[model samples]
Target: MRNNIAEMEFLYSQESIATQFSRDKFHQFLQEDMIFPLKGVRKKYSKNEIIIPEGEVTNEIYFIESGNVAATKDGENVINFYAENEIIGLTNLLLDSHSEYAFQVISNELFVTKYDKESIIEKVINTQEGYFYHYVHMQNQVSQMIEKEQLLRLPSEQRISLALLILGTKFGEETNDQDLIGFPKSISKGMIGQYTNLNPNTITNVLQKLQEEEIIYPARRAFYVDIFKLEIKLDQVLKK
Candidate 1:
């Protein structure tokens, strides 16, 4: 693979260097020997493409540059969805084992920077910035895992409510009227079921209830959470 030095920082950029240095200065620093690994490539995938097959040994880690990728376990249950600027396969790199879940491109297309796992680990320890970036990444990963565990312990109705809240927080965009926090686009109920490990029937019922209560607006293609109502419900749950 031809080295794409400048793009490598996207692999684990908690804070982009572009904000700190001029473009030319940033490139100049990267050009120095061993500052960042040059063993990476930029790649793209079409929608529904399998980026990383479950059980496959992943020698490389991917940093998403754009679009969305869904990580799923058992071919249907979603572990999580990753969007632009998030690194995939970091946990796999740390474990040094075959991938526990499959990663698939869910949007029309996906762009990612791929790097060798070993090279990344080496550089991460040698550089303070890299160390801090990886540290934050790991913390975020652990927090998400803990959140998921908490979700799993809730009753299905509360669990679904919390799942929608999580998705809305991650992918929501403010509406023109500022009353709704809608996702970039609609997501299917089946996908929601996959994420929450709830049955299709249960998901449909729960969503219908939420819609009737005006806590959310659900549609066949996608749904939007009522930010105000959602916050109230979340607070209620927290106080329980």
Candidate 2:
């Protein structure tokens, strides 16, 4: 049981890196392909704009050119986040179901290439590379959901630590210190609470403990993490 738990946690922690690589390759294909430019329309969204409302029928696919968007449950709980080079709406498009969450632009400005569902099916999905991208995308999405569910089942401290580590790996920028990584200010403590389904007070307390331990520290515009220290601390927590 101990070995199983440890192995599961290791795979969950590594999912972000795997997802990043898949997203990059998928985006690269879209960028190089001529079908996208011919069949898709480019659009820009301002911050806080709703791209898709909850329960709405998804009719189009969106490819992010720049900026980020968040998928929220009932306009509050952030279920997921999509950044530049990521594609949204494919799941809903393929499933032919209503959107489970509201997607909103989180960056100051978001640029995306939008493709109607039919166009995507007939133009992109029919192609060999496109089908492969879709398969990999769906696989990554499933892995993320499974990992997130497992992380949420952990104790608050471990949950928060692993959540930050995943987010840091996906969206963070490397700092001068090879061991440190910096996540954008958009990944606030409140966002962390929402993502983990934890109370605000609990999030605050756990974050404070992490700070005191020097595993993570806050900057004016970002959260800086000592990746090595954080992994060690998380391993200790898991053993306990």
Candidate 3:
């Protein structure tokens, strides 16, 4: 396995060379024109901890360097957040382009980069790529979520099934001789409603219906959904 951060850090000098930026111009832009620092504090968040909340009026952005996260509200996991330099909180403020979900770390993670409100504005003014990259990610995120919302506009039963379909496609993993679908972290029922158009109560009702149909089971708080059967129902209904 690759050496983890702690071991790697101990192996290197504190003042050792910083990693080169992929494009030198971006680095130059950050160093001279941008107000953000060379290296901000590396924040550490444990599993299930909220890194940022939905609709909060703040321009702080984080570029993930390690660990996975999930976005949710009141307890249904909607989006699985990736690292790989993906950004958080780079979208517009006054416009309707703001964040629609809260991000929580799914495990202990080291988040490497950050930019507060003023620094973000300065960078946007100075570097087109800087602004453009964030805008593209924001646009992609919003569009995907909007498409998901549309898909879930079906009756509560179908919408609930579609949610499982998405979770299976992106985040499912097998366990204990079964093709188990597990949530990386829990998401709020209220958040699921925002995506599904069905209110939390409706969602709960649909969950109960699926449970009665033997399509899913609730373990403690998290629900284990049958992704294959859910997809079969979705395929049958979505075509209608």
Candidate 4:
């Protein structure tokens, strides 16, 4: 049983590492040398600013130059959070659908390069690197959607834990403690509940339990996470 647990940990770590590498590659493709030539307008957005409102038709694609954004449905349910180097609006444009969620700036400030749908499509078809980046971006989007679906099916505690893990992996910064990673405090309990489709009370309870366990703790304007401990907790839950 111990061996099986170890194996699962190894598998999860390997998958996490690979996913990180893919993310790095995607960002690498977004460098100035690649994007500067594109006919895109660089724009700055203030916190809480709406980039695309729900039900609007998305005729543009946005590449984050800096900062964070969130996609929320009905102005409440958080569908996803996007950080630097990530692309938004592509999914809706590709699917020929209206925006189902509002994309809003969650950071103090956001800088993004926006390109019209036709211009981006033309670039994708005309440039080898653009085509590759587009492919990778689409792949990552699908993977994220699938992961979110899987987490939502988990029991409340596990679902919230996994959600935090995902957010930490994406937005966390290295801390003085080697075992702890810190993510923005802007990601509140309410946002976590919305992200995981759980009640606010449930989010509060689970977070309190995690804090008690020392798996996650609050920092100054950030939350410090012990991912190793959290993964062990998840493994233990799975064993049950």
What are the per-residue Cα lDDT tens digits for candidate 4 across 24-116? 464454444655345578999999999999998778888898898999998889999999877887664463568888999988999988878
Superposed on all Cα atoms, model 2 deviates from the true structure by an RMSD in Å of 7.0
Cα-based lDDT for every prediction: 0.74, 0.78, 0.59, 0.78
Error of 1 at 238 (Å): 4.1
- Measured by TM-score, the strongest candidate is 2
TM-score of each: 0.80, 0.83, 0.57, 0.82
Candidate 2 per-residue lDDT, tens place, 53-124, comes to 999888888889888788899767989888887888887546457888899987789999887776566644
Candidate 2 ranges beyond 4 A from true positions:
1-37, 94-96
| Model 1 misplacement above 4 A | 1-34, 37-39, 94-96, 184-186, 218-220
- Give the per-residue lDDT of model 1 (tens digit) for 1-240: 012333445553635533443223322332357577455688999999999999988888887878888888989888888887777886644645799899998888988878788877766666654544454566578989999989888888988888888877787777774657875463467777888889999998987888898988865566677877977987887799
Q: What is the lDDT for 19 in model 4?
A: 61
Ranking by TM-score: 2, 4, 1, 3
lDDT of 3 by residue, 1-240 (tens): 123334434554433312322322333445563365444456777777777777655566676766667766554645544553556665563323446777877645545466565665566555544554344445467767786767755677777677666655565556563545764343445545655666788888887888898777777756676766777777887889
Better of 2 and 3 by lDDT: 2
lDDT for predicted candidate 3 compared with the true structure = 0.59
Q: Residue 147's C-alpha lDDT in candidate 2?
A: 89
Model 2 TM-score, 2 decimals? 0.83
